[model samples]
Target: MHMTDVLAAADISKAVAAFAAADSFNHKQFFVMCGLKAKSKDDMKKVFHILDKDQSGFIEQEELCLILKGFTPEGRNLSDKETTALLAAGDKDGDGKIGIDEFVTLVSES
Candidate 1:
């Protein structure tokens, strides 16, 4: 299945899942899963590419919302309060935009 399909099917922490599968995804297994090959840097780039659908070199609000949908893979959707909090925390410019850098930073910090 596609990664996003795996994500949507999950009912737990994606971080936990990814970490648990780290051995496989770290360098080798990702190739097997995706039918492609790449170095670590390339892999990271692909992830960011997937996150930046608009190809604006930055993630926007809609992109962020899609990402937030996957944050809690436990099938426990975020409450309105939680969503608001997430936007507030990551919307650095406060122009109602959360760029890819901001999202990446927020996810990394979390």
Candidate 2:
């Protein structure tokens, strides 16, 4: 179903407020919530490109850490330990980095 179909006009304010208050918003959740996937893969691709700061095909340690900063309400950065753990969880290829495929896989499954 479309996002609009799922969300009433009256519920929009609350949904947006909740989204804004969230510490972190993942791609799959976003796509599903906004019905972007129902439209096309382009939205996901755009989000990925935006997160890929250096335009590198892969997301490296620093990039992940930088992004994690937005994952907390306090604007706190991810510690090295936290970053490593995140990598361990998301880097499926053992390549020490997260590729687009891995990224999509992580979010889609979550």
Residue pair clashes in candidate 1: 11-74, 59-100
Q: Model 2 lDDT vs. the true structure?
A: 0.55
* Candidate 1 Cα outliers beyond 4 Å, as residue runs: 1-68, 71-76
Alpha carbon lDDT of each predicted model = 0.45, 0.55
Task: Give per-candidate clash totals.
Answer: 2, 0
- Strongest candidate by lDDT: 2
Residue-level lDDT tens digits of model 2 in 28-69 = 454455443444345445545555778898778988765433
Residue 26 in candidate 1, Cα distance off native in Å? 25
User: Looking at candidate 2, what is the lDDT of residue 91?
Assistant: 94
Candidate 1 lDDT tens digits, 3-84: 4532332422443344242122221232223322322434434555665667787655565445423333332333444445
**Steric clash count of candidate 2:** 0
